[model samples]
Target: MLDIFKAIILGIIEGITEFLPISSTGHLYLADYFIKLNQPKSFINMFMVVIQLGAILSVILIYFNKLNPFAPSKSHQEKEATWQLWLKVIIAVLPSVIIGLPLNDWLDKNMTTWQVIAATLIIYGILFIILENYYKKRTPSLTKLNKLSYRIAFFIGCFQVLSLIPGTSRSGATIMGAMLLGTSRFVSTEFSFFLAIPTMLGASVLKLGKYFMIGNAFVGNQLAVLLVGMIVSFLVAYISIKFLLRYVRSHDFKAFGWYRIILGILVIIIGSIFA
Candidate 1:
C-alpha cells in the first residue's frame, strides 16, 4: 500500500511536469530519492520511462482531431495540412532517434546524475527567462505550423539531442529551439506535443525490450504498479496539457524559467545535504 502511494505521487509529479518546460525525469528522480521505492534499479528506471506513455497519451487524446489526418469531419485541405504536420513531426523527431539510439547507454552511465540535472535545470531556466525578455517586444514571424520550414523542423530535432543529458528536458529543448527559429510559442508548444508521441513511444518500447532482455520477469505486482502509475499520470496529464495550452496564450514562459531555477537550486541543496 505504501509503495502504491509512492507510485501515485510519482505519477502526479510526472504528469504535472512532463508538459511544462520543467524536467519530468528530474522531478521523478528527486521524488524517488526521497520516497525510496523498494524496487530494483532496473525496474525503477523502466517504470520511470514507461509511465511517460501515460502523459504522451494525454496529448494524443487532447489533440486527436488535430493530429488525425483521416478524421471524417475534416475537409480535404485540412486533411492535407494534417499530413504535412505529421511529416514535420517526423522530421523533428528523426535527429533525436538517430543520434539517441547509440548514445543511450553511455548517457545513462555518465549523465544521469544529480549534479548534471541541477546544472541543466539552472542553465535552461536562465535561457528561458532571457529569451522571454528578448522577445517580449518582438513579434513572431512563424505563427503557424505550415509557416515552419523543413529546415527549421530539422533544427528543432537537432536541439532535442541536447536532451540526451537527462534533466535537459526534451520539450524544453524543442520548444526553445522552435522559438529561436522564429516560431511562435503556440506552434512550438503544439509541435512539442505531437513530437512527444513518437519519441516517447519509441523510448517505452526500447525500455521494455531492455528490461526483458536483462531477464526481468514480468509479474503481477509489477504490472499493477505500472498500470496504476500510467493511469494516474494520464488523468493528471490531461488536465495539465489543457492548462498549459491555455496558460501560454496570454503569457510567456518566464514563470516556468524562474520555477526551474528555483527548483534546481533546491534540488542541489537537498542533494548535498542528503549526500
Candidate 2:
C-alpha cells in the first residue's frame, strides 16, 4: 500500500512537470532523493522512463485529429498539411538521435545530481526571462506551424540537445529555441508538443529495451506499480496539456521561468542544510 502511494505521488509529479517548461526528470530525481522509494535501483530506473509512455499517450489522444494524416474527415489539403507537419517533426528529432544516443549512459551516470539540476534550472530560467524581454520589443515573424521552415525545425532540434542534461526541460528548450528562431508562443508551444511525441516515445523504447536486455525482470507488485504510475500520469498529463495550450494563448512563459529559478534555489538551499 505504501509503495502504491509512492507510485501515485511520483505519477502526479511526472504528469504535472512533464509538459510544462519544468523538468520532469529533475523533479522525479528530487522526489527519489527525498522520498526514497523501497524499490530496487533497476526497477526505479525503468519506472521513471516507462511511465513517460503515459504522458506520451496523452499527447497523442489530445492531438489525434491534428496529427492524423489519414483522418477520413480531412480534405486532401488538410491531410497533406498533416503529413508535412509530421515531416517537420521528424527533421527536428534527428539531432537528438544523433547526439543523445551516444551520451545517454554517461549522462545518466554522471549528471543526475541535485547540483547539476539546480544549475540548469536557474540558468535556463534566467535565459527565459531575458529572451522574453528581448522578444517584447520585436514581433515574432513566424506565427503558424505551416510557416515553420524545416531549417528552423532542425535548429530547434539542435536546441533539444541541450535538454540531454537532467534539469533542462525538453519542451522548455525546444519552445525557447523556436521563439528565438522567431516563432510565436503558440506555435513554439505547439511544436514542442509535437516534438515530444517522437522524442519521448524513442526514449521510452530505449529504456525498456535496456531494462529487459540487462536481465531485469519485474518482481512481485512491480508491474502493478508501473501500471498505476502510468495511468495516473496519463490522466493528469491530459489535464496539464489542455491547461498549457490555453495558458500559452494569453500568457508568456515568464511565470514558469520564475518558478524554475525559485525552485532551483530552494533545492540548493535544502540540499545544503540536509547534507
Candidate 3:
C-alpha cells in the first residue's frame, strides 16, 4: 500500500510535467530521490515511461474535440484542413521513428548513467536560453493547419527527433525548433501538443512490447499499477494543458527556460553528491 501511494505521486508528476517543456524525466528524477526510487524493481525501472502513456491518453481525451478528426467535414475545405493537419503530424513523427529506433539501444545502455544525463541536461538547457531570445512569429490563430507549409512541417518533425536524447525534452526541442523556423510560439506549442498524441502513444506501445519480451512474471500487478497511473496522469495532464495554453497566450517561455537552466544545474549538483 505504501508502494501504491508512491506510485500515485509519480503518476501525478508525470501527468503535470510531461507536456510542459519543463522535463518530466527531470521531475521524475527528483521525485525518485525524494521517494528513494533509486533502488528499483524491474517494473519500477520502466514504471516512469509506462506512466507516461497515461499522460498521452490525456492528450487524446482532452483534445478529442479536434484530435478525433473522424467525422466528415461539412465542406471541401474542412476535409482538406483535416488531412493537412494529419499530414503535418505524420511528417513530424516520421523522423523520430527513423532516428529513435536505432538510438534506443544506445540510449538504454547509457540512460541510468549520471554522465549521460548530466551532459544532455546541461547542453540542452543552454540551448534553451539562447533559443528563447529569438523573435516570436505572430502567426494568426485563424491560419488553419492547411495553410502550414510543408517545409515547416518537415522541419518540425526533424526538430522533434533531436529529443531522442533523454532530458532534451520533446516539447522543448520541437517548440523551440518551430519558433526558430518562424512559427509563432502559440502555434508551435499547439502543434506540439497535437503532435504529441501519436508520437507518445507509439513510443508507449513500443515500450509495452519490450516489457513483455523481457518476461517479467509479475506482469499482472505491473499492469494494474500502470492503469492506476494512467488514470491519474490523464486527469492531471488535462488540467496542465489548459493552464499552459492560457498562460502562454499572455506570457513568454522565459520563465520556463530559466527554470530548465536552474533545474539542470541542480540535477548535476545533486546527482554528484547523491547519485
Candidate 4:
C-alpha cells in the first residue's frame, strides 16, 4: 500500500536524525513537501512521535556493551553513582513533560507551520555555530557520565523543551547546553543518546495512548505500516548512530549546521515560489 511506503520513508528519516541533533521533526516536516501520505493529521503527527521508539531502541541496542553503563561500579561509593545518572536523566526529562506536553495544544495549533520551522532552523543554526565556538574554549574530556552534574542536566533538559518546536533539535539543544556547561563533545553526544531513550520512549507511549483512546488504532493495514516503519527505522537508525559517532570524533557539527542552513533556505524559497 502507498501508506506503507510513506511510513517506511518517514521511519527512515526518524531513525537517521532522531539522535543526531539535526531535528527529526524538522526533517519530517520538510519530507512532507515531497512524499505525500493521506494519513490524517491525528495519525501523521502521532506517528512521528511513535516511530521514534524505533530509534530510541537503537540506542539501547548499541550501548548495551558498556560495563557499568547506567550503573556505577558495585562499590558503595559508586553505588549511588549509577542511580544518580538515572536521576539526572529523569530530572532533565521533567522540564519537557512540564513544558512540552502541557503546551501541546498551543504548539500544534501554531508552531507546526513551515514558517515556524524555517524560523527555528535559522535561529538554532546560529546558536549551534555559537555553541561550537564555545566548545573550542571549554574542552573538558570528562568521559564518564557520572561526571555530569544534576544542574547541568536540568539545564540541558530546559534546552530540550525548546525542541518541542519542530525545527529545534532536542539532541542539538541538549548537546549545546551540555557543551556550554562544560561537557566534552563525546560526553555530550553520549548524554544526548542516553537522554533520548527516556524522552523518546515517553513520547511514543503518549502517542500510542492517545491513538488508542481515539479508536483510530491500527488495524491490519495500519499495523503493517507500523511494523514496516519500525523495522526500517531500527535498521537505518543503527547505521546512522554508528556513522554519526564516528563522524563527530573527526569533525565538528558545523557540517550539520550548513545542512540546516541550506534546508531552511530551501523552505523559504519553495514557499515563495509556490505561494
Candidate 5:
C-alpha cells in the first residue's frame, strides 16, 4: 500500500515534468532520493524508465489525428503531410538512439548523481533564459510545420544528443534547437511532442528488456505498482500536455527557465546538506 502511494506520487512527477523543459529524470531522481523506495536499485531503475511510457501514451492519445497517417477522412495531401511529419520525427530521434544506447549504462552509473543533475539544471536554465530573450526581438522564419526541413530535423536530433546528460531535457534540447534554427515556438513545441513518441517508447522497451534479460521480472505486487504508476502518469500527462499546448500559444518559456534555475539551486543545496 505504501509502495502504491509512492508510485502515484512518482507518476504525478513524471507526468508534470516529462514534457516540460525541466528534466523529468532529474525530478524523479530527487523524488526517489527522499521517498527512498525499498526496491532494489535495479528495479528502481527499471521502474523509472518504464513509467515514462505513460507520459508517451498521452502524446499519442492527444495527437492521434495529427500524427495518424491513415485517418479515413484525410485528403491525399493531409496523408502525405502526416507521413512527412513522421519522417521528420524519425530523423530527430536517430541521434539519441545512436548515442544514448551505448552510453545508457555509463550515464546511469556515472551521471545520475545529484551533483550532476543540479549542474545541468542550472546550465540549461540559463541557456533557456538567454535564448528566450534572443527570440523576443526576432521573427521566426519557419512558422508552419511543413516549413521545417529535413536538414533542420536532423540538426535538432543532433542537439538532442546533448540531453544524454541527466538534467539536459530532451524536449528542451530539441525545441531550443528548432527555435534557434528559425522554427517558431508553437511549431517546435508540437514537433517535440511528436518526437517523444518514438524516443520514449524505444527507451521503455530497452529498459524492460534489460530487466528481463537479468532475470528480474516484476512479480505480482511489483506489477501492480508499475501499473498504478503508469495509469496515473497517463492521466496526469494528458492534462499536462494539453496545458502546455494551450500555454505556449500565447506565452514564452521564460517562466520555465526561472523555475529550472531555482529548482537547480535548491537541488544543489539539498544535495550538499544530505551529503
Candidate 6:
C-alpha cells in the first residue's frame, strides 16, 4: 500500500512536469532521493521511463483530430495539411534519434546525478527569462503550425538533443528553439507536444527492451505499482495538457522560468544537506 501511494505521487510529478518547461526526469530524481522506493535499481530505472508512456497517451488523445490524417471529418486539404505536419514532426525528431541513441547509456550512467540536473535547471531557467524578455519587442514570424517550415522544425529537433542531459526538459528545449526561430508561443507549444509523441515512445521502447534483456522482470507488487503509476499519470497528464494549452495562449513562459530557478536552488540545497 505504501508503494502504491509512492507510485501515485511519482505519477503526479511525471504528469505535471513532463510537458512543462520544468524537467519531469529531474523532478523524478528529486522525488526518489526523498521517497526511496523499495525496488531494485533496475526496476526503478525502467519504471521511470515506462510511466512516461502514460503522458504520451494523453497527448495522442488530446490531439487526435489534429494529428489524424484519416479522420472522416477532415476535408481533403486539411488531411493533406495534417500529413505535411506529420512529416515535419518526423524531420524534427531525427536529430534526437541520431544523437540521443548513441549517448543514451553514457548519459544514463554519468548525467543523471543531482549536480548535472541542478546546473541545467538553473541555466535553462535563466535562458528562458532572457529569451522571453528579448522577444517582447519582436514580432513572431510564424504564428501558425501550418506556416512552420521544415528547416525550422529540423533546427528545433537539434535543440531537443540537449534534453538528453536529464534536466533540460525536451519540451522546454524545443519550444525555446522554435521561439528563437520566430514562432509564436502557441505554435511553439503545439509543435513541442507533437515532437514529444515520437521522442517519448522511442525512449520507452528502448528502456523496456533493455530491462528485459537484463533479465529483469516485475515481481510481486512491482507490476501493480507500474500499472497504477501509468494510469494515474495518464489521468493527470490529460488535465495538465489542457491547462498548458490555455496558459500559453495568454501568458509568456517567464513564470515557468522563475519557478525553475527557485526549484533548482532548492534541489541543490537539499541535496547538499542530504549528502
lDDT of each: 0.88, 0.91, 0.76, 0.79, 0.88, 0.92
Spell out the clash pairs found in candidate 2: none
| lDDT per residue (tens digit) for residues 112-213 in model 2 | 888999999999999999999998899999988998999999999999999999899999999999999999999999999999999999988998998899
Q: Which scores better on lDDT, 2 or 3?
A: 2
Candidate 5 Cα deviation (angstroms), residue 61:
0.5
Q: State the lDDT of candidate 6 residue by residue for 1-275, as single tens digits.
A: 88899989999999999999999977887898777779988888888876799999999999999999999999999999999999999999999999999999999899888888889999999999999999998999999899998999999999999999989899999999999999999999999999999999999998899889977877999999999999889999999989999999989999999888988997898778875
Candidate topping lDDT: 6
- Cα lDDT of model 6 overall? 0.92
lDDT of 2 at 116: 91
User: Model 5 segments beyond 4 Å from truth?
Assistant: none
In Å, residue 220's CA in model 1 sits off its true spot by 5.1
The model with the greater lDDT, 1 or 3, is: 1
Q: Estimated TM-score per prediction?
A: 0.97, 0.97, 0.89, 0.90, 0.97, 0.98
Tens digits of lDDT, candidate 4, 152-246 = 89998888888888788888888887777777777888888888878878877877787779787655576677778888888899999898888
Residue 70 error for model 6, in Å? 1.2
**Better lDDT candidate (1, 6):** 6
Best by TM-score: 6
Decide which is better by TM-score, 3 or 5: 5
Candidate 1 — which pairs collide?
A: none
Worst 10 residues of 4 by lDDT: 64-73
